[model samples]
Every structure is written in C-alpha cells, then in structure tokens.
Target: MIRPSSLIFAAALGALAGCATTSAPRSGAAVAPYRDSIDLAGRIAINYSRDGKRESLSGKFTWRQSKANTDVSLISPTGQTVAVINVTPSSATLKQSGKEARTAPDLDSLTTQTLGWTLPVSGLRDWLQGYATAVDGKRFVATPANDSVVTRDGWKLDYVSWQDDAAAVPQPKRIDVTRIALGQQVDEMAIRIVIDPVAQ
Candidate 1:
C-alpha cells in the first residue's frame, strides 16, 4: 500500500497561505490577475527510491483553494478516486478510497514523520502560478529568459513550458521538480506536473 503520507501532496497544495507574498512584476512584465480562489486540474507524477527500491506513481488531480479552505482529489488513470484531502488553517485531513481518514498538524510534519522528506509547502502555491519564494523569503518570477530556480528549501524547480508564449506574462503549463537533499533524509526523488488549461 502506498503510505498515506506519500499521497499528501494535496495538503501541500492547501498549505498555509499566510506565509505567501504576492509576486511583484519585474519591470515591464505582466502578471496574471490575482484571484481569491483558484481551481485547477492537472497531471502529477512522483518517483523516489527508498530502501534500495524504486517506486513511482502518476495520476490526475483536481484542486480547489480559497482563502478559507482547500480541497483536492487524486484520481487514477482508470478514473478511480485514489485519495481526497482537505486542509484548513489548523489541520489537514487525508482520506483514501477504503481507509480511515488521517489528520496532521501540517504537511511538513506529516510527510517528515511518514516519508522522511519534506514537501515544498512554503513555495508550492506560488510555484503553481509560475513564481517562487525562496527560504529566505525572496520571490522569483518565471520568465522565458529565466525558467529555473533553486528554492533553497530542498527542491529545484524548472518551469518547462508556458501556456502562451505570446502573452504579456505567460503562465506555467509544465513544471519539473527535483530533490536537493544533503543526507539520507531524502533520496532521489522527482516530480513533474502538467497543468490543464482553464476552460472557457
């Protein structure tokens, strides 16, 4: 069984937003309009080596985030509900198709206790919008000229493609992430995300 915590990427999606700063546009660059809530559907893949064995998972996900709450659903390629996660300011809950729901104080603690690694909870929300906030709290915006950033928070991110190259500020369509681990706490791990375009 995939350990439940391995599937808590949804909690990371709903991580605390109080720490996030709105991205500032670089001179002459445009940014997507800010919305109080965001809804997205996409593909996600995770690969990692543990106990000398390699494991991988790939699936589709739907995410809904608002100021007050966030809900995420992980779906298998065969269209089965793999897991569902709900997160709020105080707690996070994960429920798989046939298992009891698990709760945690936050994603970092949950994943650390279960997976021996940390998710980029501090930076993921910004990353989804093509921006990043490093551990020191500096913001990096993605542009064609500069598409990769080492977040200094244990991961390196690459904005592989954009939704519209001709737009004033292109939004990320695909993102690649790799672990930057110093010790055994994190082994070789990689994640790739491909975001679906918003429906008209």
Candidate 2:
C-alpha cells in the first residue's frame, strides 16, 4: 500500500497536471485566452481531505500542451522535484520522487494506481479554463463575470476566484473540487487548489 505522504504527493501532482505547461507569451504578442489554448506555469497549494483526514501540500508546476501531447512537472515547496507526468494520445507516464517511473494507458489510470483514487485529469483541461467538459449529465453554472461551478461524472468543481492580470483575461486563482462515490456507504474526497498566476 502507498503511504499517506506518498499518496498526498501523488494526489497533489494529479491535481497539478492539467493546468501545468508553457512559457509566458512574448512581449507585445497577443495573449491567447486560456479557453482557446493554454501553456501555463504557476505555483500551487493543495489541500485534500478524505473520510475526515486532511493534508496539505504546496508546490510549483509547469504545464505545456500542444496539439499532439502534454507534459507537466510538480516541484516541492522547498524546490525539490516531486513528479513529472507526460500524456499522449496513446499512453501516459509518471515519474515520482524515489519511485520507479510508471506508465499506463491514461492519466486517470496512472493517478488512480499511485494515489488510491482517480483525479479528473481529462475534465480538468476544461475546468482550468473556466469551461465545462462535454460530458453527459454535466451541469455548469457561471456568473456573467466568469466565476463558475461545474458538476459531472461524480465530481464537483467550484471556481473560487480569478487572478487580476493586466494584459490577459483573468484566470482562475483558486478552485475547490470534490468527488463522491455512492454505495452502501458514501465515500468522498475534497481538494482545494490555490494557484499563483503566471504571465501567460
């Protein structure tokens, strides 16, 4: 079984994966809206709770995405490396601190194995952009100013706030997410993310 601390690291990295990537746009270049495309780098603080147990982790992350693939890295608060994840159409790979690199068919499967639960890696790409994924049963609500909430496929996302960048459209600075599983007994996981916006 994975240790709780390792699970925390894995979960933190999983949460960081989709929003990490890309350098800032060049000076004088038009800033592409996040909803159109994203290449972002930022710092993140993650708080997670399950069954009444809570833990927190802080880190830096870089997320780069292109038409063909995506890559993300999570760095510890003290500047040590935590994990790296790469995703392609056919496969995903995760390299964690002090562990053998592992590969899986997809990001969800890889994170589920490493973290003891799955994160919404696929949906997060849209969630990070203040948009909802095109999944059945999904419900999304947004304010005229762009703050939003989304529920789909057993997960709920609350977009708490946006950064006040001068040149580009505001991007999410904090989000709270929860996943619920139904059965004889309900199981739930809660995650809170605090992001420090980058130039892009």
* Highest-TM-score candidate: 1
lDDT of 1 by residue, 22-107 (tens): 76645554667545588988998877676788877788888787866667788877788777777677876777766777778865
- Candidate 1 stretches with Cα past 4 Å from truth are 1-19, 23-25, 113-121, 181-187
Tell me the whole-model lDDT of each prediction, alpha carbons only. Answer: 0.69, 0.59
Q: Using Cα atoms with residue i matched to residue i, what is each candidate's TM-score against the true structure?
A: 0.83, 0.70
The clash count of every prediction, one per candidate, is: 0, 6
Candidate 2 Cα deviation (angstroms), residue 41: 2.1
Assess candidate 1 and give its TM-score to the true structure.
Answer: 0.83
